[model samples]
Target: MIDPSAPLPRPRSDLTEPPDVPQVLTGALRVLQGRLLLHVSPARVGYFRPQLDAGRSGLVLCGPNALQQARKLRGAEQFGGPLLVDPAVYEVRAASGDEPFPNACEDTFAFDDPLAVSLAEQRAVGVTAPMSPTGYLHAEDSEALKAAVRQVAALDDPQVVFAAPVDVGWLREEDSVRQLIACLRLVPGPKALMLGGQMDPLARHPRSVDHLRRIVAEVPGAALLRTDLAAFGALAAGAAFTAFGAGSRLRHIVAPGEKAKTSKNFSTSPHVLFPELMHFFLGKTLADRFAGAAAPVCGCAVCEGVRALDSFASNAGDRQTRAAAHNVAVLMEWLRTLTALPSGRARQQWWHERCLAAVDRYPLLNAQLLQPNGFKVPPQLKRWALAAPADEAASARADANDYRRS
Candidate 1:
C-alpha cells in the first residue's frame, strides 16, 4: 500500500542530469502501446503488485503531500514501473492563498521548492531525473513557470520527462489548452507526462477529448496519468502511454478545495468494471442484475465459467477489495485484446467497434432487466464510439515512436 505520509529526502548532488534513462523505465512505456497502466492507491496495492511482477505495469503517483509514501519507495528498488512523486504545485485559487501545494497529502510540504523536494525524493527512490522535475505551469506566471520547466528540461536527462498536471480551466477552454501545449512544447523533453485534474473519469467533454487528441499530436512522447477509462481513448488517440485509476478517487483528480459527494450506503461497494460495456457499475447493482433470469455472464478471466461477478454484491471492505481486483483484471483483459492487434490502426479500429457494441448493449441490458431506467450509456462510451482514431500514416509513426516500451 502507498504510504500517504512518506516524506522527501534532503537535496542530493548525484543527479546533475544523467546521460541515459535506464532501460527498465523506457521498456515499460514501449510495451504499453495500446495496453494501459494503473494509477494505484494504497488499499489496492496487494491486488496490483502481483500483476506488476507478472509483467503488468503500474505507477504509484504521489503529490507534495504524498512525500512520506514517496520517500518510502526508495528501499523498494523495483516497484513494477515508474513511481512518480508529483509536485502538484498548480492551484485553483493560487491568488487567494488557499493550499498553495494542492498535491499535499497533508500540510507537511513547506513553502520551500516542492520541485526540489520531488527531485530529492525521486533520487532517493531511484528515479533518474535529478535535473528535470515535472514543474508546475500557470499561464499568469508564464516566465516563472517556463523558467522552472526549462531548468528541469535543460539537461534533458534520458530518464527525466517533462510532466505537467493540467488545471480544469484548460480543459473547459480550448484556446487555453492550446496555449498550455505551446508552453509545454517550449521546454521539450524526450517524453511528457500529462496528468488530468478535475475532469470526468471517462472524459466525456468533447473539448477535453479534443484537447487530449491535440496534446498527443503536439507533445513529444505524450503520456497520461490519472485519466481513468479515458486512457483507453488516449491509447486509441496514440498517446505513448496511459493509466486508469484503481478506484474512483484517483479517476478524476479533485481540485485542492473541491468537495466530493459521498454515499455511505454504497460507499464501500466496489465500482465494478464491466469489460463488455466498458462501464463501471456498483457491485450490488451487478449482483442484482445477475440474479435476473436473462442476465449476462462475464467471460473475462475474473469471471470465467462457474464463477459469477455477482459475488461482489456485499458492502464488506474485503469484498470490495476483491471486486476492485476483478475490475483491474477486466480492464487489463480488454486492453490486452486491443494490443494483440498488429498495428495502431487495427487496434484503434478494434477499440471503436468494441465501444459501438458496448453502446448498443446499454439499451438491450435495460430492456432485459425490465427496468424503466436501467443502464444509461456513459457519455464517454458514446463519445468513444463516435470519435475516429488517428489513422493517418504520420500519426501512426508518431504513436509508434512515442509509445516505445524500450
Candidate 2:
C-alpha cells in the first residue's frame, strides 16, 4: 500500500523499469505500478477515491484549489504518498476563459516572497515544493526562470524541482534543447520538464525525437512529465519517466492564449496515431479502410466489439471513457517493451523496426511515411533500414514463429 507520508521516489541511473506517472486528474489509474505519481486536481477529488481504495503507491498532485480539500478528506492521513501542490498560477494568466484574477495584469506571484513562504508551509504538511509555472520565451527569460527556480530551491530545499517550458515548438531547434538543458542544470536537484502549450506538432516531428535523445544524453536524470501521449517514445530515448493525463480533454501543458471551454457534445471516437505515418484516423474510418485487410487497427477492449463507425459514435460518454483507458493502456505497453530492452540504442532500434512493421502491415499508410521530410528513420536505425523488404518480412515471421513456439 502507498503510504501518503512517504518521500517521493528519487531518480536512478538505471531506467530499465522507469516509474509510471499518470495524470490521474481526469481518468482512473489503471496501470498498477508500485510507487506511481498521480496528478490530481481539487475539483476532481472525487475521481481519486477509487485509486486510494486500491491502495496504490503514489503521490497526489493537489492543484491550488484542491489543496484545502485534500487536507480535509476523510482518510487524508491514511493515504500513502506525499502531496505535491501545483500553484497553477499559469492557469490564472492563461486564456482559459476563467474569470481573470483581480488586477490580473499588474499582480505577479513573485517567488521571493509569497511563494517561498507558502511552499514552506506546504512542506510542513507533507506537500512537495510548489512548481514554478515558468515559460521559455527567450534566452533571457530562460535565464531568469532558472535563477528564480534556484532561489526557490534554496528556500524550500525540495527533493525535485518542477518547471514548465512554454512554447515547446522551439524544441525543433537543437539550440533550444541545449539551452533548456543548461537551464535545468542550474536547478539544485532532479528536474521535471513540463512542455507548455499544444505539443502535437513537436511530438510528431521526427527531429524532435533526436532533440529529446540529446537531452537524455546531457541530463540523464530529468523527468519528462505531463507530455502528449505521442511523445511517450521519449522513454526509449533516455528520459527517466514520462506521463499523460487520463482526461480526454486534458493536455500535457497549458500555454498563454490557450482557451478552455466546456461542451455537452461528448461524442467519443477512437483514433489510432501512427507516429511514423504522422497521421490518425477515426476508429470507424480505420475499420472501413481495413474492411478486407489483415492489419489490426487496435486490440484494446473497447475496439473488440466495435464493428462500425456508428457504433463508436453512439454513446459519447462511454466511448470517451473507453478511449481514454485504451490510450493509457497502449502507452503502458510501449513502456514495458522499452524497459525490457538492454540499452537506449537497443530500444531505439526496436521502436524503428516496430514502426516499419506497422507500415508494412498497413500499406495504405505508406504514402505518408514515405513522403519527403516525412518520418525519416533516424541515423541510429540505419543498420535495420539496410535490410531488404523481404529480409525484414522474414525476420518478423521468424519472431512470430518463435513467440508461438514458446
**Tens digits of lDDT, candidate 1, 189-241:** 43444443444633535666666666665655566766667777767666666
Pairs in steric clash, model 2 = 2-80, 3-80, 3-81, 4-79, 4-80, 4-81, 42-66
Candidate 2 C-alpha lDDT tens digits along 1-406: 1122322223435444433222222111122222224455566544433433233223345355455654554245455444455555555453111211111323435333544444554555545334544333322244344455555456544354455544555465655565666555455544566555443434434465555545544563455655543334455555544444434333455554666443233333554433333234454544444444444445533355342332343335565445434444454545555666764457656766665565454444435334333233333233223322334547988999999999
**Worst 10-residue stretch by lDDT in candidate 1?**
1-10
Per-candidate TM vs. native?
0.75, 0.60
> In model 1, which regions exceed 4 Å deviation?
1-35, 53-56, 63-80, 87-112, 128-148, 190-204, 262-264, 390-406
Estimate every model's Cα lDDT from 0 to 1.
Answer: 0.56, 0.45
Top TM-score hit: 1
